[model samples]
Target: MRILFEDSPDYEMVLGDYLERIPISWSRDESFGLLKTRLVAEPETTRDLAEKVMDNREKGGELAGSLLSAIAETSEGQDWMFESLTSGNVRKEASALVMLLNLISSITEPNLDHNLRLLKANAQSVSEDNTHLLLWCLEEACEKERDIFVPLLEEVLRTRGVPAASVYLSRPSLHRERPVSALVLAVEILEEKGLDNGEISLGLIGIYPKNREFVLERLKRWISKGKFPDSHHGMLVAHLKKHDTSPIIALIEELIDSGNRNALYVAANCLEELTQSISEWLGWCEKWESDSNKEPAVIRSLLEILSRLKTYEASGDRIRAIELVQKFASRSNIDYEDSTKHISLGKYSHEGCANTRQENRYTLKRP
Candidate 1:
């Protein structure tokens, strides 16, 4: 088979014929040994053979399992498999890699420590298409060896960024073993790249309640540096609600003061999240009203916050929030015409007040 793979003009078709004959003509152990040798010498060929075996297994060929097991046990076979992962540059070998990972994962006695180390080493060259394969292989290997794989997991997260990194970090099973390392790597990625995607941000926030100080502090630092994107503010606020709202409230206020449109948008969402606490809403409204140099952006954000309040059930806090909106609007020299369109203070009138009792009934239209 090895000679055919190297020397034959029509190697692929001949190799396919040889693979089909292995189960019928050879003993299980001999077939396994021959496939392993072929795998190390010609990975791409063996990958084709392995796929044939897998397809045959689906049809009840028992020798496929033995072939895969032999490949998993040999160091050379593992190396060949990893090499096959990166061999296709133009189009990734996704199907073959998936089969390879499945084979490696099925071994009852896998050399996971060595395999994980090799995976970590290979992870440095990962491209977009092969990332999922690498992560799946890492996850399977890590399941067998946590202590050895955790650092490698962090390395993969650091090198691959969030889309792939989130798979390992977001898994509930591995959260207890050095999750902070993954969190810190995520923070570093955020600092370097900003919130290009929400996967890492959401992953961090998903684990925030568990790792409060570390996650919150990093979130705050990212927000302060203008690292987080505006679109992500809503997700951050939603997760922040699970922890103490005080720091999150303070962060939102700071963001409102930053005069950033996205930050103010996030602040509005955060305030809406905090609106269940009327005192906090009232306090923020009062604070914004007292400031003489309220930026139009801040005022607009404040108006959104007040408009959200109109949705609250009729309570003293709701009334105070409405009054605060009117006062803030008046102080900002926003007339009834302007206020009605943007702030919707007309909602506070008798007719408007009557309709505020229903859940999510009030929709704030900010100009």
Candidate 2:
């Protein structure tokens, strides 16, 4: 609950000002959060207020969904959803239906059948005017339940052709892979538009499993920009998980060779879960060590990775890690040390570090 101070300005006045001015604002989503805070005070009338929000959810373009999506989470807002959908205002209906699609696919209840039936019925009636909203709804729904929405998606693509496919291709999300056919269409769209178009390469659609290596040549800079296991890094991680192959390993190997400490950390972090065998990891270590001019921070991070590696009993497993530890055991690379102690030249009483006898000793960080 918000604490309303006597000295504070009136929420009702503030709400009225926001509701009136926001439609004409240069940016709608900017102050939407403040509007959301004030919006709950009068949920009884939120349906009427939300009708205005839904208007912008349509005409206000992509960013406007911020408020519209938030309002959908409110009980009163949801109660008014079907009313707005069948209210004969195409814009409001489409906006409301997209949120309905988001909810039905993402959450389930006993009455979910009723929602699905209504969704399909309204979806069938979607015309060219509603195609934009239809695709918006399709992306969210299809990603969650391919069995249900892919047919609808396919039908839309069949009817609308490349123009419709181009829409999805431009703004594809890395949250999950789109259907194979949709991606094929996306590839065709890019191929037709030509890779010379700079915008096409920036999309995750280009990274579809087919042209992955080709697209990575363009996206490695972005992957480098990923300093952590962030969403960009996740795209590669997810890419590997999808392919279930080691093609992306070459890319990580390249990043490790770049001699950037963050790149080393990110590359190692990305491979942490790809452990099919010890050889896979040992190969990566050798790749790092093979760089004769490797940065000390990168080497230390490598030490941390191997020292913390899950012990797999085999020839040369952890040998390079031990070798790395032994070589760096005498000198602490404090310049490159991660203050989190994530990377440090350390002497430790760990089973993995038992083989490396070091003069300068600090406890190794552990989970």
Candidate 3:
């Protein structure tokens, strides 16, 4: 059955109307093969056909086959398009490239390999304007067709150097699903290929705004998998907000057990959200201090949490606060020396940073 514009529905009509002159038919399947044929043929209708397909995909719910194929046609010499896309000559053309890149991503590879090839080839082109867009497409490609695209992108990264790939590595949607694998691989590439810390941090944070549970799940997986060690500190801390008490508590306890000083600092800083009552705060301080025998990090993290929560938790029942903190802190060495002394230091310490003196005072002054 021939698909005609007038007879077909709006989605098919718009696409058909735009590509009327192109000598192509839209089959539900095999659009990729056709696009490959047309790309090799170098037909003048190629870009128009690609644009129409994207238009249909963007507006219609489903992406067009031919448009997807155009992205997949990865033969040599197609690198020029990446460069052409970045030039200011025709905004329409550039926009069409972006549209095609955005729309074609929905099609799963081996169909995606075509666009990946184009991106890999053009990744190093001197097109600063369209660079971010291309990187975004690569990020999506990594998500949709990870097996096919990651190696290619990695190779492209190695060739151009890891710094160039920072943009692609950090795209958020790429991390919307199980991002641990990508983050691990990305951290490896940055370290092995010599990317700077700034670049790595930027990419890591790209995945940070995802849910706390999501991050926690990935963190556990990463630990189990035993990779990406040098990065999680900043990533975890950067993600901490005032409302993250549960995870912060669990993380602090874990770090204390693990004996990682840096993680301890981060975990302690995270607790700064728990400062509701002196008793509750100091009670926890006493327990952890009792168990650890003068380990400053645990005490510090507890104090920080308590100090921050002071006013927020102050109106709470004093006796209840003491019982809660005391109950929670009951398990350990229970050091109130510093926390008590620093209770009056105020929860907000400006830039002086969290220290033993503040922690000690915070614990002692809590009546």
Tell me model 2's lDDT, rounded to 2 decimals: 0.53
lDDT string for model 2 (1-367, tens) is: 5533121235334433444455322122465555555545655444444444444333532222333444555676566567656777666665566556545544443445556666667775665666766776676667656788788777776677656666665554545556766655554565665432323443444455665655556445544665334543444445455565465556666775776555555665555544455566555556555465443434655656666654523325455555555445434454223343464425545654544322122333333
* Clash count for each candidate, listed in order shown: 0, 0, 38
Candidate 3 structure quality by residue, lDDT tens digits, 235-322 = 4344444244455456556755776555554443344433344444455555565465324644565444545454423233333334
RMSD list, candidates in order? 11.0, 12.2, 12.9
For TM-score, the strongest prediction is: 1
How many backbone collisions does model 2 have? 0
Q: Against the true structure, candidate 3 has what lDDT?
A: 0.47
Comparison by lDDT, 2 against 3, better one = 2
TM-score of each: 0.50, 0.43, 0.43
Question: Over the stretch 323-357, how does candidate 1's per-residue lDDT look in tens digits?
Answer: 65566566658774454554444446665455453
Task: Score each candidate by Cα lDDT.
Answer: 0.54, 0.53, 0.47
lDDT of 2 at 43: 57
Name the 10 consecutive residues with the lowest summed lDDT in model 3.
59-68
Error of 1 at 223 (Å): 4.6
